[model samples]
Target: MLRTTVARLTVRGLLGSRRGLLLLVVPGLLLLMSVIARGSSADKQQLTATILGQLGLGTLVPLLGVVVGTGVISTEIDDGSIVYLLAKPLPRWQIITTKLIVAVLTSWVVAAVPTLLAGLVLYGTKDALAVGYAVGVLVASTAYSSVFLLLGVVTRNAVVAGLAYALIWESVVGNFVEGARTLSVQQWGLAVARAVAPHGGISTNVGLGAAVPLLVLVTVGAGWLAAVRLAGLTLAAGD
Candidate 1:
C-alpha cells in the first residue's frame, strides 16, 4: 500500500502552492483553443494533431511533470524538512514510490484529462485521435515524473534542468536531429499514439519496438536511482 502520510504531504505541497495554479495555464489554453478551433474551417485532423501533439503532449505534460515532480521533493529538500521524513525507520523506496505516485497522478489529471477533453471537443472521437493522444500523455507523464523526480533528489536546480531538456533538447534538438529524436520521450509517446490513432493520423520518428523499451528503462531506472540516492541523503547539522 502507498504511504498515505507521504502521499498526503506531497499532494498538499503540490496543490496548495502558486506553482499549482501555474500548472493550470497550459491545459486551460488547450481547452480554450479547442473550443475556438471547433468553429474554424480548418482540417480537423491537422488541427487535432497540432494542438494535441505539439502543444498538449510536447509542452504541457512535461511542464507539469517538472513542476509537480520537482515540487514534491525539491521543496522539502530545500527547506531542510525532508530530513525529518528520512529520520524515520521507513524504507527509502517507499517514500520515493509514494511521491512518484502523487507526481504521476497529478500530471495525468492536469495534462491527460485536458488533452482528452480537448480531443473530444475538437474531433468528437471521430478517429480516436483524442484517446490516442491521451494514452501518449499518460506514458509521457510517467516517464517525465520519474526523470524529474530523480533530478529533484540529486540537484537543487531541477526545474532549470528539466526546462532545458524539455525545451532545448526535446523541442529544438529532437526536431532537427534524427538520432536525438530516437531518444526523446515525446517521440516515444508519439509512437504509442501512432498505434492507437487511425493510419496516417499520428506521426512518430521512433518505432514502437524501440519506444516501449526506452520508456520502461527511463521510468524504472530513474525511480530506482532516486531511491538509492535518497537512502544516502544527509541532514546538515543544526547550528
Candidate 2:
C-alpha cells in the first residue's frame, strides 16, 4: 500500500517545516544531556535506565511522533490542499501508509540515534543497553507514528492531542496509575528494552506477552482507522 509519490511529498513537507528543526534540536538536546549525565557518580546502570528508559523511550520518542506524524498530513488537511491529493486515483490507504512510513522513519532517526549514543555515553555496551533502547525506540516509533497519524487525520488539534496523550496518559498516568501501565507505548518499549538488557540495567511492568500484542494491535489498528477516515475525506471535514 506504499506509494513513492506520496512518500516523496510527505518527506519534503515534513523537512520543509519547523518540525524538521525539531528533528535536529531534539537529538542534540538528548546527546547534551547524555554528556551531562555521564559525569554523574550515581549508580551507572540505574542512571542509564532512568535516562534511556524514562526520558528516551517515554518522552522523546512520542513527542517527535506528534511532530512528525502531524507534520506529514495535518498541514495539508488544515490548508485544504488535501483535496488535490484525494482527487488523485491513489487509494486512501496508500496515502496513509506512505505518510505513516515517513513519520516512523523520521521519528526513529531523530529519537533512536541519540538514545543509542546516550546509552553508550552513560553505560557503554554493557547489557546491550544502547542497542536495546534503539530497538525499543524502533518499535515504539512505529506504533506512535500510526497513532498520531490517525490523530492528524481525525482532528484539527492533532499536535495538542498527541502531546497530551504522550505526556499525560503515557507519562503521568502510566507512572502513578500502575494498572494503566499496560496500555502505554512506553511500557511496551520498556518490555523490549528489558528483554534486550536482561542483565538488569532496565525494568518494566510490561512483558513481551502483553507488549507485543498491544504494539501490533495499536500500530495496525491505527493505520486501518486512519485509512478509513481518509476515505471519507471532504475539504470541510479535513479542515
Candidate 3:
C-alpha cells in the first residue's frame, strides 16, 4: 500500500504549480487538432495514427514524463529539502515507490487520457484505434516515468537528458536507424498498441515477446536503482 502522506505530498507538488498548467497545454492542442481533423475529409485511420503516434506518443508523453517524474524528486534534492525526508525513519524504497506511483499516475492523466479523447474525436473507436493508441500511451507513459525518474535521481539535468533521449534519439534517430528502433521505448509501446489494435495503420518494429520483458526490466530496474541511490544520499552528504 502507498503511504497516503507521501502520495499526497507528491500529488500536491505535481499539480499545485505552474508546471501543472504547462503540462495541460500539449494535451489541449491535441484535442483541438482532433476537433479540426474530425471535420476534414482526410483519411481517419491515417489521421488518428499520425496524431496519436507522432504527437501524442512522440511528443506529449515524454515531455510530461520529464516534467512530472523529475519534478517529484529533483526539486526536493535541489532545494536541499530532501534531507528532511531522508532523516525520517521511512524505508528508502517506500519513498521511491510512492513517488514513482505519483509520476506514473500524473503521466497517465495528462497524456493517456488526452490521447484517448483525441483518438475518439478523430476516429470514434473505429478499428480500435483510440483504444490501441491509448494503451500505447499508457505503456509508454509508464516506461517514460520509470526512466525519467531514474534520471531525476542521478542527474540535475534530468529534463535535458530526457529531451535528448525522447526527441533526439527516439524521434530523430529511431526513425532512420533500424537498430535504434529495436531499442526504443516508443517502439516497444507501439508493439503493445499493435497487439491491441492489430491494424496495419499502427506499425511496430518490435514484437510483444521482446517488448514486454524490456518494459518490465526497465521499470523494475529503474525503480530499484533509484531506491538504492536514495538510500545512500544521507551517507554521501555526510561524507
* Between candidates 1 and 3, the TM-score winner: 3
Better of 1 and 3 by lDDT: 1
Clashing pairs in 3: none
Candidate 2, residues 13-118: lDDT per residue as tens digits?
Answer: 9999788899899888888998998999999988988888888788888888889888999999999889988878888888898899888888888888788888
Per TM-score, what order, best first? 3, 2, 1
Q: Tens digit of lDDT per residue, candidate 3, span 82-194?
A: 88888777899999999999999888888889998999999987788899889988988898898888998888898789888888877767666888888888888888988
Candidates in order, TM-scores: namely 0.95, 0.95, 0.96
Cα deviation at 85, candidate 1, in Å, is 0.5
Ranking by lDDT: 1, 2, 3
Worst 10 residues of 2 by lDDT: 230-239
Each candidate's root-mean-square deviation in Å? Answer: 1.9, 2.0, 1.4
> Distance (Å) between predicted and true CA of 37, model 1?
1.6
In terms of lDDT, the poorest run of 10 residues in model 1 is: 230-239
